[model samples]
Target: MKFLLVFTLVSFIISFLSDRNKTFAGTKKGLKMFLGLLPTILNVLILVSVFLYLVPKETLIKILGHNSGWLGITIAAILGSISLIPMFITYPLAAILLKSGVSYRVLSVFITTLLMVGIITLPLETKYFGIRASILRNILSFIGALIIGLVIGIFL
Candidate 1:
């Protein structure tokens, strides 16, 4: 994280020094991008908070924790595939689940599927990539995530 911050800072500094006008335009574009994503970010934050608050810790543990086994991984993967969560919020929420007794395997599957398999974004994906391609890509990604999760579970 520190490396990223430093790299970004240095890049921004170089960009500003080399071309002030371009730098300013880039900053404006970046701000617009942030604004565009703000609502989704806020929604994810609220959704995560509400979910954690409404669902009892014991219930969460019983469903997704170490004792929950492959069923828990399947549940998490399905939820991840269906949900439209920003990566920033999803990771922290995953970490919270980890702390709450969710197994590494479950978290691994959830996080991987959350990133790769976009069931919720199928409409947009299909519009861009064609329905067949989009569906195949999602299916492949889901399979890949499961394999990756299994490897991570074995190694870590």
Candidate 2:
């Protein structure tokens, strides 16, 4: 993380030096985008926190543990589809789940669907991409996530 921060800072400095006006403009645009998404981000964080608090570890284990089999995969897929957590948070959470004995198959499906399929963001996606395209993309992504999970389960 420190390396990434230093690298990003150095890269930004170089870019700023190369073109101050463009750098400032880009930074401003990025900040604006961040601000625009801040509300949704905050909502997701709160929802995830509440969910974690309400759903005990034992319940999670029962649902997604190694012995859960295909039912767990289906549950994971549904949860991932509906969830709105960011990728950074997803990875750490995945690691925690793995440590807690969640099956690799379920985790793979959850992470894949969480990243690829966005039921919670369907409205926003439809607004930008049209309903047909959004729905088709999500369906394909869901199928792909399942296939990927199956393959991962086989290997791991």
Provide TM-scores for the models.
Answer: 0.73, 0.63
lDDT of 2 by residue, 61-137 (tens): 78888778889999999999898877746776687678766889999999889989989889999999999999999
Task: List the candidate 1 regions with Cα displacement exceeding 4 Å.
Answer: 99-101, 120-136
Runs off by more than 4 Å, candidate 2: 1-62
Clashing pairs in 1: none
Count of clashing pairs, candidate 2: 0
What TM-score does prediction 2 earn? 0.63
